[model samples]
Target: MTQIRSRPRSELFAAGVLVTATAILVAQFLTATPTAVVVGDESTRLGTVGWQFGLHDVVVIAVAACAVGASTTALLNGIGSSSATSADTTCSDTSTQESTDSTSSELLQARRQEWETVSERLASNEEQVYQAVLDADGVLPQSEIVNRTELSKATVSRTLDSLEAKNLVERKRRGMGNIVLLT
Candidate 1:
């Protein structure tokens, strides 16, 4: 495959500023007398006397400012570009997430329609909690079971314990919560 790259305006602008500053500093250093190279000295005034900022000092300060500006611009641009890169990754990931969500939703709906055909006899709360987990693609947090099934936390915990006894669900500790996985 033929690879192509695109450059952003901020990088190009920073590069231009860096190059210009470098060239000016180098040319001034090479062509000026040794006295002129001494920054902030009154010798640069040629005939003027006592405590004055000369042209050489001004040029050196301006060049330093440009170099500093270029580096800061590049650093800030890099930070902004990283966020843009993540946003691009999220846009790409959203499509795959939507497909997976839809497939899981369809499977859950079919299970809901056919739940009565199951061979095992489960309590109504157990069945509702199981359907909630199945709706979440068979992996869910225990706290979410309470929310999805509209049951109290105590009730959900008791139901989960009952389901565990029957080998219908398992709960694993995950940070501050338990992730319920269907067996």
Candidate 2:
């Protein structure tokens, strides 16, 4: 099956701005009040109505301004932060990442098989947390393990500590996050 990917945020934001502007213009055209009023005097052919600010107009203007500002900010950030890369650079990075991912998956599969061998002796929560880590390429962040297993952070941490004591997994500090690795 072919996957349908979404456009970048800046593109979506710009499109939104355009669509909103078009809708506002169409609505104004369809429901516009007259800009001129005829007086009962013959001195003037037509007296142009003075400018009047309505709450609706003010609201619309504010919304449009906000949309435009957001769209422009997104576009500018995308442009300024983008760095040029040659095809060779991109292909090299992609190939490296693919190899790393393949190795990780292989390790994870082996870890799963090992877990299956001793899963009968494991408690339900421990098994669940272990399986979650095994599914994560043998290395995952503790927070991600919690999210995947649908367990509370405290529960995941305690289970991980227990697993570490049994030599089934290893937890190490990685920056501000804890990285769990299958042993």
Candidate 3:
């Protein structure tokens, strides 16, 4: 599994610092004016500029500066949020994979248990079929066993093969059918 790291603190801090510096610079620029007119210089008093005065200009500059600051803050916050979301997504994927693996393991265990139960049932069925043949004087046709057990041909055939391999039954070919004898 892969580990996801959080957004770097330094990048967030730098963004904050940049926004703050921009606001400060905008404030300084808006308030800045030519030096005050000297009382002793008549020409300087007439020529020196004072703070610009206009309701519209002040409103426009203030609005523009605020918009810049707001947009910058929004951009930074968006980046941080996106990074956090990506990290969360990675964690979610890991959790999902773990759940899938656990489910698959559980399914495999269930299948193995089912196979064991089936094997036990098959062994029991084979024993019953063998006893039936012995009770019938050691000679029982495959059809009779199939009719008695109500099992499929393939299953009966496999069981008889297993019984023969165990030396519990002997097989003799007779025409198209096999005569099974309990040994």
Candidate 4:
């Protein structure tokens, strides 16, 4: 019998980044001083009352941003590299539907039926956008969805926004474009 391997359990890179960022943040806070440079007093001229960030401030901001981003990434896909392409990594073969070891085959069937039922109730534009992502196995680049639907980028974006608002789909930032995921 052929055995299927389950998803990988380690998000090494994201975890490392998170840990490093945490250390940096702690060190920064512990040593932090008044690093904000005030150009003028509170009652000074309108344009002269700006604050300039010193090196300490910039480092703190950068570390905080990195920590937030890494934590979000790890939390979302920490269980395994999400089956969704565009979250972190793409499937080795994007054209084929791979067996999901995380969920049983029967569960897959139920999920498919559930999606079909949901699709039936969506508006035309929403359905088109939703179908594009569904057809891509619950994840596709927003650009790809635009191509598949032959709809204007604006239309697809608007539809996606509506779908997201309904908690039917989610859009995640991926480089220049977003990746749409079925929720």
Q: Model-by-model lDDT, in order?
A: 0.69, 0.70, 0.64, 0.72
Which pairs clash inside model 2? none
Model 4 TM-score, 2 decimals: 0.49
lDDT of 1 at 119: 18
- For this target, which candidate reaches the highest lDDT against the unseen true structure? 4
Lowest summed lDDT window (length 10), candidate 3: 79-88
Identify the runs in model 1 with alpha carbons over 4 angstroms from their true place.
Answer: 1-120
lDDT comparison, 2 vs 4, better candidate: 4
RMSD of each: 17.4, 15.8, 28.6, 15.3
Residue pairs in candidate 4 whose N, alpha carbon or C atoms collide under 3 angstroms: none
Could you give candidate 3's per-residue lDDT for residues 5-57 as a string of tens digits?
34346556656756765676577567755555566645545455566535665
Error of 4 at 12 (Å): 22
Order candidates by TM-score, high to low. Answer: 4, 2, 1, 3
Count of steric clashes across candidates, in order: 0, 0, 0, 0
Q: Backbone clash tally for model 1?
A: 0
Q: Please provide TM-scores, in order, for all candidate models, with all chains considered together.
A: 0.37, 0.41, 0.33, 0.49
| Segments of candidate 4 deviating more than 4 angstroms | 1-106
lDDT of 3 at 164: 71
Candidate 3 clashing pairs, residues 3+ apart or interchain: none
